[model samples]
Target: MRSATSKARFPILLLTLLVSISAAAGEKLTALQLFQAKRYAEAQIAYEQLAAADPGNAETHFHLGLLALRRNATDTAIAELERAVALDGKNSDYFAQLGSAYGAAAQAAGLFSKAGLARKCRVALEKAVELDPDNLDAREGLVAFYRQAPAFVGGGIEKAYAEAEEIKNRDVLAGSLLLAQLATGEKKYDAAFATLDRVLADHPDAYLALYAYGRIAAESGLRLDVGERHLRRCLELPPPARAPAHAAVQWRLGLIAEKRPDLPAARAAYAAALELDPAFSPARDALARLPKP
Candidate 1:
């Protein structure tokens, strides 16, 4: 277990202070500006003040819940989100976040306790989808539930596949990658690749699809050559088409090279990742772990 002082802190959420917030009717924008500036500690304090001032504001609690989740304070996240849902019972997004918190907490729980948390996750996610049929994240959370939990508790690839079909009908690009990811989770590599093939065929320049393709290939140790190719292409894309987190693609490339036992390639990729964003700890750690030559 980590030390108590650090358990609820994330430096990534505390990085920049460039953008300023214009004075607005609501202080929520102020908190948002702080969050965007990566001043997470200040943002949390601001959010706490907002929540205290407006005890009935559901959105305040929701934002606090998000901040807590980013800090890995899942228990706090669940509490804040519960308040959000209690105040605004109609919000699908609130319930979805609560479910995500439950899921995160369940990862470290004992077997019996894990089951209970999983049940909470399942219930909240289902409620979110019921409240909003078009809630994509809620639907994906439910799919994750079916993929990971036991049959008695709600896990089933069959359920995930059914949800995948619904997603497919909604957004072809995202849906295809999501379906492929689900297939990957099921250990159906061939099927997953075939689905990805369709994604590439239809939208050859898609940012999400390329990242998904690279991630699956690297993580699964399948089609390494193809994975490396697409991952490199993903890294080369301009900001508009690049992944929101630019260093992520470089890390994926590093992962591919490392898994292939290509030490020099892995080191280069990791170095490139750190060059893009020195705060990217995964790349930094990977680079540090390489044997001194």
Candidate 2:
């Protein structure tokens, strides 16, 4: 009897193991994972498949919309995001991304369509902020809108400053960076410089801050020597962060060196950038333009 019972349990265990393996095989990754990995093409394909299988899935539509936006397919993005909103109107992130899509679409639209699209962008962004005040990205989007749009529309520089203050409460460095951007946009270079200096003084090894400072200083010709140092420091940052920006840093340093009359250094920098990103057009252009040493 005991031998018979043991034999019976063997089949049940096998069945359980097979079920687990099958479930594992069938598991689907969340769309956000693909999006965060910057695999927009793959994510779009996955989302398209998902939306076809589950026609009422708002998240699938929303992710498709995001992928379309990334690819600058404004019309498709609008259609997908509208469907997402219809299915899940309360999703603040969907509205925020939709707002961004509309904003981009407005840039190239005809005069007749431009005004209407801008209005839609403003309204969607506002709704996103209202729905989730804690969402830093949404707030930043609204701030950008406010800073860029004319006073005739639903945007004001004062409103942007107020939002900047709110951001400061959460992230001091981010707020300062925004403030610098605002000043730069307004052509208040001195003010922007002060803000960048403050950030670097506090966080000397801040990779992003250093990169921004270098780019600005180099482009503006404010302090080419100092800018070179900052760019070098940015390159020194270890791995992960450094790898993604390697080509960019090298290109910017090339530009600075070319303008500073250091032709050899400029050529070397451009060559380095090209070695990393073979198709980097800016570096190629700069390298071609340089006089041979």
Highest-scoring model, lDDT: 1
lDDT of 1 by residue, 1-293 (tens): 77766655645334322122223234788888888898989989988988887789898899899999998999899999999999999999999999999999999788879999999999999999899988999988887888778898888888888887787788787678778988887788889888888889878877788888888988899899998888778767764543546688888888899888888988988888889999999999988998865
Candidate 2 stretches with Cα past 4 Å from truth are: 1-46, 239-244
- lDDT, candidate 1, residue 179? 85
Worst 10 residues of 2 by lDDT: 23-32
- Cα lDDT of model 2 overall? 0.83
Q: Pick the candidate with the highest TM-score.
A: 2
Report the lDDT tens digits of candidate 2 across residue range 120-181: 88999888878888778888988898988777667789899888878867887778778877
Give RMSD to native, each candidate: 13.2, 5.6
Residue 125, candidate 1: alpha-carbon lDDT: 93
Score each candidate by Cα lDDT: 0.85, 0.83
Query: Residue 199 deviation, candidate 1, in Å?
Result: 1.2
* TM-score on alpha carbons, each prediction: 0.74, 0.80
